[model samples]
Target: MEPASHGLRESATFDRATIHAIQRAAETGIYDIRGWGAKRRLPHFDDLLLLGASMSRYPLEGYRERCDTDVVLGTRHAKHPLRLSTPVTIAGMSFGALSAQAKEALGRGASEAGTSTTTGDGGMTPEERGHSKHLVYQYLPSRYGMNPDDLRAADAIEVVLGQGAKPGGGGMLLGQKITERVAGMRTLPVGIDQRSACRHPDWTGPDDLAIKILELREITDWEKPIYVKVGATRTYYDVKLAVHAGADVVVVDGMQGGTAATQDVFIEHVGIPTLAALPQAVRALQELGVHREVQLIVSGGIRGGADMAKALALGADAVAIGTAALIALGDNHPKYDAEYRRLGSAAGYFDDYQDGRDPAGISTQDEELAARLDPVDAGRRLANFLRVMTMEAQTLARACGKAHLLHLEPEDLVALTIESAAMARVPLAGTNWIPGAGL
Candidate 1:
């Protein structure tokens, strides 16, 4: 029914989606829970434009000149830092949240692209370790599958303070998705819903975190990099505190960061945008006199090379991707549209990752559905996508007269909107004004 045909106007405050939410709440008496990142529109990388070289600056020839994309992370305190050919990396996605095959595919793709992949919440899997050249083991509060041996085997360790999608909340794995293998890995009952602890049980403050870092360094003989990851809220202080706690690298995840399952309210209401948090994190690092010494990796809504280049220009050493990587592995392919519809969603609109019924096999724990994904083929597709992103970033860097991706500065960028100019700390297009620059 079209409102226009009935000559009726819809309320701006109570839209159709809002009305549906009210109806759902009344029917189920439960708050909505779903997967993916923040769906709300916010200031993002698209609001920033790169200024190509014309008069004062010189642009490099596309085929004749070189623009390096190599990046070295965790050079501050680690004996062996991660030296990658490109700055893009795969973000953490737990073994329980994703199938073993999907984890292996991520490892293969990242390895082929000369980058790193992380072991998310439920701990390291043998398949991922075997396929990945450089793997960062995530140390979450849950301590799901954590072991000293896995810690020693990891190339790097990331201590997760919080996730962007649920800043003050824990992770959720419904009973439907909690298969025997997933339950065993997480040390929980096979058909029971699990919720992780929001904070580390042993540590409460920076001092304890410092001790934890020391323990991790001792466990690994100080050979591996120690990273501290925090959600976008209080990013400046979080970065400062993480560095003070002896972190070798810091990763800031914005509100747009994806999750396997979380409350709808938490996903849309908590944390700031990636564009707004990057500058704050950079300022914190600069103030500590370790701007480049302690690397910064930002994640949230990074989609392509343009977003990656923009993040680098804003002072991030690298960018991590989660949702985009899954898409690359064919999570929402058009061929699965019919199956998606049967599941009450379309290919592009599917976000029910916790249901354990994924048609593409990238997010399910079901045996038959999981087998539908060919890890080898999916890995090749992911590799191709990563290569294209790297090339796109290089193209943008050349146009901006940057000899390397790390050379891209905020000066080469201009904001298309006042909000973006204020958030990105760049000048507005065709003007020298930066909103709230002095404030």
Candidate 2:
């Protein structure tokens, strides 16, 4: 007899109490960070602490400091300027992963907050394009739902080299969520696992990609701003090549960014983190003498104001958010905790985004499930969150004595932890600091 199965040790090493802890059980589902694991918790903007102005430095006021967050992304060459009131933007997430209502909500919020929202793996939808004031059309490797009309409709175009979630691998539209609509849009069979091509079907390398970008610009009459987005691998080289290839902007997504649906192994195993990639991308752009000329948008794990400020100070022209926006739109609400557990997962822990069974209704395509979410309410909440993030970012910029948020520099920062120092490129607090170049 097995010594009468004493407490939480149903899984050995873990005691019965540990097994009973809902948070512990949900570890595999959520709260797991890429690269780091159960051991290291990501410090929020509130955590890891802040060091205010001292004898050496002077502080600025919350209200008195001039915090100009205005950004003109593609004014150098484009016929139209990609002007934004805030430095925060929205990352691309799929139509299949989210209902049409959700996409519309993102557009409404981003537009209201003076930022841009991206189209996803699926092609441009009329709702998204119509609602978004500054819409970006994503030319993905998969090319799902892509057409000439969308290319014309977009304010900007992003040629996707890779996504941070599964850098080299293509994505799968699982059988469960592959409805007739999604199937027809992708030109694939229904109720089957649809695999998107990993590499682009047409061109192979940088030289060929340059021609392709030109072809697109010509096709669009050189009116739209063309961007190139790549996962954070070989970023220094990729950023240089993307600029050479004639990108007006470069969107670099880091490993911690969320995906609509991807393999668990892929989500956890691949790519460099955002903290490691931002500096290299900036260094590359600086080397090319186009650091701010060709804008750089950094995505992945951008939660609050400090992250936005830190990313900008390190060289990102703008920051994009995905998971955090979903949270603002009522994801993981305790109101659905009972229903979430009924699905064998709790609200905060549920990340099975593939099956279209989300209780919060943010990530599902089912009629009843999608209806659970009201787009108007969700959009308002997201707009409010965007406002708060912008406000906080401005506050921090002011505190650092910077006239504008774009004026924030590494000199204004001091890292509380070793990781923060390396990631933020700031000196350690209370000491003479050194920086590491990850090679």
Candidate 3:
């Protein structure tokens, strides 16, 4: 069955020729196994930060002076608009992968911060729904826990096309974290690893996706905003399509985005980075005249005030956080170095959320491990982080001579690195690359 490997090999840019040999070795049980992006370190948002105003710039009062973070997400094309009191929101992480307490904590934190929380591949949980003032029901391809009642109760509905960690990939839930409760939610056989299909069951392209949006809107009787969430890969085209499909809001998630559990290969090898994605999403919105009409929420490795400010400057109306929130809830602290090392990962670098062995206790289904986390405290930390992000974003906005966070412009940015500059399409500090210098 392996006859044609001799001729076409010359012209092939990439070939599956090595896979045959590799699979055989893997079949004999692995040794020093590593996955994509597993061995290589990529530039994260934390690698660079923003510099605030100086003599030529004015600062905004953190405690007072009206820094409005309010955003109306669905007004552009929705009968019942989705409103947020702040620009920072929570990205979806499944309840099973993250203990119920963690999901509740996220809800509590977002509520305290005056924003929204999203459901993951699994359906809505009463605890999360009750705590989150604004709950977005996710309609992922898996259709797990999906019910009409949940959809009816949602403040909005998000049709998930792709996520940042694995843009064109599927969702994964490791067997260890698949508790009975989780199993029931996903309707899968107990103790088996589950993978969600990447493609939607009903649609293929954006045009079909638009119809799906319309159908959902009609199903809800136009009472809720319809949103489209796509990974950062093709934000420009996807955002434009989401708007054309009558989406009231488009959320762009970047590669650095978090997941409960995925193969290291999927996490690192796939998707565009958030820094590169925000601008593309904004451009799409602007071209469609829905830049602010419909809203844009960006996520991926967003950790602090600097990231939030940078995202807003790049033209996002709002932002979402995942890993950072977990950190706020006490993930990867040095105290857990011993436990992390036991799992073959360092304390500050663990990403195996599906193992049911999170040292921080925020991402485990094991009762004892889950109990180690205090939701009340974690929620408070998340709120504080959100406040700081707001403060920083406001400060940057004022320094740029803008009165509101939404007014922060690309003109205020100078690339910290060449790759960032090229990908973001911005100029170096002293370059003519920025045609609109100070708009």
Instruction: Report the number of the highest-TM-score candidate.
Output: 1
Using all chains and alpha carbons, the TM-scores for the candidates as numbered come to: 0.99, 0.88, 0.87
Q: Residues 300-330, candidate 2, lDDT per residue (tens digit)?
A: 7888988898888788899989888988888
**CA-RMSD of model 3:** 7.3
- Give a tens-digit lDDT track for model 1, residues 143-252: 99999999999999999999888898888888988888888888999989998989998998899999999999998899999999999999999999999999999999
Give, for candidate 1, the lowest lDDT window spanning 10 residues: 163-172
List runs of model 1 lying over 4 Å from the truth. Answer: none
CA RMSD, predictions in order: 0.9, 4.7, 7.3
Ranking by TM-score: 1, 2, 3
Q: Which residue pairs in candidate 1 have backbone atoms (N, alpha carbon, C) closer than 3 angstroms, thus clashing?
A: none
Candidate 2 TM-score versus the reference: 0.88
Model 3 C-alpha lDDT per residue in residues 1-439, reported as the tens digit of each score: 4446655343253345346436846886532222112223454444334545678776665556666767878787667776777788888887887889898899899889888889998788888998998888999998999998899999999999988888888887778878899899889888898888889998888889878888888789888988889998878888888888888889999888887766655776788788778878887888877678888889887877778877887788888898888888888889999999999888777767777888778888888988888888888888888888888777766666567777777766777566776666667556646434355
Local distance difference test, per candidate?
Answer: 0.94, 0.79, 0.79
Model 1 TM: 0.99
Candidate 3: residue 3 Cα off by (Å): 47
